[model samples]
Target: MVQQMVQGSVDKMKAELVAYIDKKFEIAALTSDSSGASNTEETEDSDPITLSMIMLQIAAIFEKFGHYDEIYRTYGIEADAFQDECNEVLDLMRYQVEQVESQLKDFQNRLHIEESGGESAVRHNAEMQEKFEILSKDVQESISQFDQYIDTQLKQFEDMPQLLERLQQELASKQGKSESLVRLQEHKSEMIAKIKAAVEELNLQLPKVVSAQIEKALKD
Candidate 1:
């Protein structure tokens, strides 16, 4: 009965933890999509002011990624601790089961001794045997359930690091792209300013060349 209760509590905790992790992944996906959309919309035709805004947005996205990364790291640590706890529980339960089996064997040995004694001893021994069988079945079921839970938890633990690593890679790629976009925008602005200055210089020299050409034509 105690083992059943403990299993129930562990199952509940597992459900809650899985739900929380799923929600975190969902939020991260949504945030990434939103960031991508914002970048797409901003990168089309950015002026200096717009570029500044993009830079700010990129900074904010980086900050958010950093926060998410920390959360992931914290989650990993918590998961490791939780795994350790589950392992300890499993080990304890296994020990208890072994002890129970030893007690069952001793009881059976006593029952065999009592079998040669009398009818009353035989009746008590039969009752005890039934109770022991029920107890053993319950213990077996609990161990089976525990094994399943451990398998599920192990799979989750195995997948988690991969998921975190993928997210980190994606964020890094986005950051690089954002930085490249900023550099390209800056280069574009510089080119525009240089072209404007060159045009102004040509405009300033055009009249002088035209007036000199007219005077030369008149002399001819």
Candidate 2:
């Protein structure tokens, strides 16, 4: 694309310069054939700019395109490095989410396999959050007083429903954390995509801008 744009700018500007030469000098110093196709050489002729300077100007135009191309390649490398880093972090987060999901599955299996005692022993509804909160606090206190836990040991395990309640609460907490991680990973990926898209847009625009600059230089 850059090649086409540069060639188009050079051809148009060269034609205009040739026409100006033919009109002002009434002679073709820049072209020898009717096709207006010939190589121009340096001469001490009086004009706005020398023929060699025109060739230098064209070389400079090509240099501009090369300069942008180098920067574009660097941008691509930097963007790739950033994406790789984000993927590494995302992989770790995915593993952690998977671990939580696995634990939740284990809790579910344990709940199904371990038969609870008669419902008549404890009448707390497992659906209520308050019941689980009470059980969780009791468990924390039991751990704090582990040395004095003969008194609290029977209290902690007296009801099988308390274990189920604690398991459900833990599962809920893990799921919430995993959901946050999933959202963060998605946002990271979206930002990376946007960055890559911006780089591509810059790549697309560089040639056009360079061509415009080349046209302006040739005109001057």
* Candidate 1 clashing pairs, residues 3+ apart or interchain: none
Highest TM-score against the true fold, candidate: 2
Shift of residue 63 alpha carbon in model 1, Å: 9.2
Listed in order, each prediction's TM-score against the native is 0.25, 0.26
lDDT of 1 at 187: 55
| Candidate 1 local lDDT, 137-190, one digit each (tens) | 655655565556546544544654565566556556775887756655665576
Kindly report which residue stretches of model 1 are placed more than 4 angstroms away from their true locations once superposed. 1-68, 119-220
How well is each residue in 65-176 modelled by candidate 2, as lDDT tens digits? Answer: 5665665576767767888999999999999999999999999888766546436324445534565565555555544444343344335436546644654566567658
Model 1: which ten-residue window has the lowest total lDDT? 42-51
| Cα misplacement distance, residue 147 of candidate 2 (Å) | 26
